[model samples]
Target: MNDYNYVVIGSGPSVFRFLPGMQGSKQRILVVEANDFGGICPNAGCEPKIFFEGASKISLLSQKLTGRGMANPAKIN
Candidate 1:
């Protein structure tokens, strides 16, 4: 079996930040992630939540203004 000088758990933001410095090094490195790559913040966390909330807000605003000012309610699909 091969040896690793660094064993990083999860390919999260910190891992990304740490990798740039190891660019030309010959040290063996291993990164392990059980779920989708790029971590939770981009996959199932803050980013997705922000998009969902923004869409929902826009949809609701469109619904509310459908007759008041907007010609039609916006549909989210």
Candidate 2:
């Protein structure tokens, strides 16, 4: 039905930002998102990917530095 004044796609941060600027006005905004509203970064984007990468890096570094100077390197848990 043609009832809404606005039809926003991908309910990401950008969508949230646009709504506030519409304040008090009867905009009848309608947000439609196929994925998580918050988007991919916090869900499965680079932000979360970094943690896994970091852990793998730490494990690699420890193995390389083992038996060189320190007594056994830190193991990845």
Candidate 3:
């Protein structure tokens, strides 16, 4: 059996922040994660929501300006 001085379960950023302080301590460390190794806020949570909202807003703006910007929709350049 192997012994670990430090065992962290999640891959979240909070746990990773401790890595710098643990350097050269000569202690056995283990990190076990069942999900993706690392995650970014913009990749998973708030950013996607913001992206979808932006798309929805663009759609709404397009509908509102359907014939306002150009005289002929078929002759767009």
Q: Give the poorly placed runs of model 2, Cα more than 4 Å off.
A: 48-77
- The per-model lDDT (C-alpha) reads 0.90, 0.77, 0.71
Tens-place lDDT per residue, model 1, 1-77, is 98999999999888999999999999888999999999998787777668988999999999999889899888889
lDDT of 2 by residue, 1-77 (tens): 66999888777667767888899997798888788777776566666568878988888898898888756766656
User: Of 1 and 3, which scores higher on lDDT?
Assistant: 1
By lDDT, the best candidate is: 1
TM-score of each: 0.57, 0.50, 0.50
In Å, residue 76's CA in model 1 sits off its true spot by: 34
lDDT of 2 at 51: 87
Model 3 vs. true fold: TM? 0.50
Clashing pairs in 1: none
